[model samples]
Target: MYQAIVSPQEDKFIAVRAGQQAAMQLPSAFYAELADLTDSDGVVPDWFGDAARQAWGIELADLPIRDVLMVRAPSVLPVTYSRASWEINKGCNFSCEHCYLEQRPFAGLPLPEKLRLLDMLRDMGVIWFEITGGEPLIDQDFVPAYQRAYAAGMMMEILTNGSRLYRDELLQTFVVNPPHKITVSMYGASPETADALTQTRGAFKSAYRGMVAAAGVGLPVEVTLIITKHNVEELGEMRAIVRDLGLPFKEYGSISPTYTGKGTTLATQVPGLIGKSEVFQGCPAGHTSFHVDPNGFATMCKVGRDNPISLIAESPQGLMRLPAIADAQMLRTGGCSGCKLSATCRVCRPMARVYQEAKAPLNHYCQHGMKEEP
Candidate 1:
């Protein structure tokens, strides 16, 4: 006997395992046809034989199968869970010249407020939650919030400047219940570069120590380098540091030209970083993830928080309205449509603001747009 099942796209032939061949009473022709179809030179891959046996408990040799072609409709909703970021605090201990979170002061959400929001998120089936701030650890309520979120079954991630994660207690907590991942922004090559970028003398040392501490606790760490005019030429050095530390790092070509923090003098001193052509463009915010400001307002991306789509409220009804807001913004002129590189671009809202302010064409960053091929 032969059994056939239809998948969403094609037909699948199932066969009985070796010992069950006699028990199943399958015909000899069934086994021969299956063998012919699944032979080494046959259309199906050899691995499929094993897969069919495991899935259907039938040997490919005993199952005769045919795959019928079918047209499949595109899925309406995306498959994976959408990610949402929450700005737990706006204040940072180190003020980097290119800091996008420059508008707000450093502070953690109140304990009561944080708990309420976590509960709401849990009820909404939010699996990915990122806790960020000037330095999220700076907030006294940080550890409790992490514990609560973990208990609620949320896979948490933290984005930090990495200066305050060196405490032994914090390191142990991270090891005990590590977030899905932690991103530490590596400022520069040496103490001077780190200090110059952060405007804090000991920040680089602290951040390096934090990375080592996190590693000791067996937590996975990813390093991020914000490439700017000052650091653009040091990509090789940065890569070496990542290799030496045995950590993963990504270089985000500088997306912001205006420094939002206190060190306006240093911010103005650095020249143009990457040109517009170098930035990959598609706004994947609504498609994959989104950012929520400290005040609970939803923004398309984390960089630009001034324009909000909706507020994160206590009720589920309010949260449901977010997609429409994202859709509306996405259709607008300056949101994701202006750039020629929009299809491949990782353009964020903050970068959009810079282009709007300068009244520059899609290529806001001159170097990326104008550089000659090496």
Candidate 2:
């Protein structure tokens, strides 16, 4: 992996340390010079070495260009973006009750097609790439796909359950390439509660082992404590486990229906946590970033997956239609249209639509939900 990445962010340019947040802005002339030197396989310029050392305290004065820098080419596409999330596959090793994916099929594009999709993402100037799934680590092509994105100077993040992270090969690859973040969900503190929640024997043992292994290597791992009725009793123990591992964690108590409007998953949501989310603030989901499904279908985001554009058929050109699609889907229609509480509504239009379709009780998503709380 390269030491740093010099890339375009909107109209300006920036140089950032690999897998870190340390960044320095560049002048137009400086970025122009770097662009001109893209093909030159020589030493990193003396000026860059000084800037990097000053900004991030890294030494790179005499390193070869190929070794020190991955200079990303500016995107020429009309619909340019700097961030995206991809579902490598919807398949997972464990069957969690709170999973939002109604169908977790173990299928996706072939390796070559996956590579082509990654290249297209690179060409679109996407730098912050999130690879998630029912569990991303379980995908067969995850490593190569991750490597390709990392080589393209994208700061990668993986969303997984930590079940498969104990594998030596996967751990070594992560240590070497170094994702910007690896977010894992902790089901429970013990095997009985966690395994019962996931419906997989030894689920807690495997997940806990993986977390320990990742922590031992000092990988950038963060835990998410999934709070459901099954594991609610172990909340304190769960927090203690993550604290003992010296890992940071956040709680997720408000579960939602499946994206396809199935309410089965919502049954796992904590009653007290319902309607606790922050009021609806506008998002930049399709304007500045988007999501891609396993089969190369691009959508506004995971929740508002209406009128998906086939990235395989249109390639990067399909993204040109996303902004308008996002706007259309975000409009407050159907049950939420012209409501008096629209200003204080908690969920987005697409999300509320799903809950309405699922026939969920008003106490789950509506502002009326808060009023119903006794």
Candidate 3:
């Protein structure tokens, strides 16, 4: 019979081998026990009834609980989607000093190529599609590309600076067909700081207006604050603003050091910009998600997007063989090994590369617990 072991450290359930038998090879005893725990009519405990309902998504009253449990078998493969973020364009109108893509070369996949990539994602059963860039909205293909994915039954997410979302009509379109989530990069709370960082006068006002417009359309919005030396102290203040706006807050500790464009100069100017907390262990790129650049190069993280993994060929098995296809097993070492705060840690491959390149150890800018670490 299979034994359910609850991980004391992570609050997760794992099935282990029991009685010299593989968990899968065990007889119906395990399922029988589960059925007994979920049975009604005073046979199973009430507490276990709820647990069984959650795990199996079946109401006890709906079926012969014992017989159903015995006959039904759970799939061996875990239920998860291949998470991918596509950089639709490499150009941005705003030039934020802290931007990893600012002043970098602008490139975009041709329309035909983009469509092919979408088909590939659909075929691979990638339920989640994140469209980002220097600014994805700037691309002429943004609307069409989004529609393509939406038609393909994929849930979409977008990351933008909120500059191009100026008109009510554009905002309305997003509301009518809302994506899973929309994240806006808020450079600063005030126009002065924002303009200074973006190196664009009056751009902050446009961005703010865009965010307000987006909110009016009933689209769920999240504010992403990129923390830097110039804005680290204002994080709490930024959180307050996000709360006031009725939006979720997603704070990035710092820009990745491996990022081309203004990142190189910014890192040099702001030494110790990153927080020193080793909240996360190693890179969680492949484990949780993957990134695809405009050129169709897939990688474990955005920083590594330019470095090619295998190309997006038309086969699932071939795609799985790509070096950038991050799996849970691949992320168990290096920065993630024995990490005390792995649950709350955000250190991914990009951040680790930044830490290694900038400092011998993890950078203070990106860590939560190592704020005072040398």
- Say which candidate scores most in TM-score: 2
Supply candidate 1's per-residue lDDT for 136.
85
The total number of steric clashes, by the backbone 3 Å criterion, in model 1 comes to 22
User: Which ranges in model 2 have alpha carbons more than 4 Å from their true place?
Assistant: 45-47, 372-374
User: What TM-score would each prediction reach against the true structure?
Assistant: 0.67, 0.94, 0.66
Q: Model 1 TM-score?
A: 0.67
Q: Report the C-alpha lDDT of model 1 over 230-262, residue by residue, as the tens digit.
A: 566666887887778888788765445443322
Tens-digit lDDT string for candidate 3 (1-374)? 11122111111222221111122222345445544444442243343345445554434433343432322222222222346788888788888666655354577678888888887766555555789988888888888788787655455788898897867655755755567678899877777777877888987798888887777666767888877666666667777877877877777755554364223535422355444344555555654456778878777667654345544553334445444445432454555568566576655544555545555334443344355544
What is candidate 2's lDDT per residue for 8-92, written digit by digit as tens?
A: 9878898887546678899988887776666776777889989998887889876887777888888988878888999999988
- How far in Å is the alpha carbon of 287 misplaced in model 2? 1.7
Candidate 3: TM-score? 0.66
Best by lDDT: 2
Model 3 worst lDDT run, 10 consecutive residues: 1-10
Once fitted onto the true fold, the runs of candidate 1 whose alpha carbons sit more than 4 angstroms away are 1-81, 232-235, 257-273, 276-288, 304-314, 332-354, 358-362, 365-374
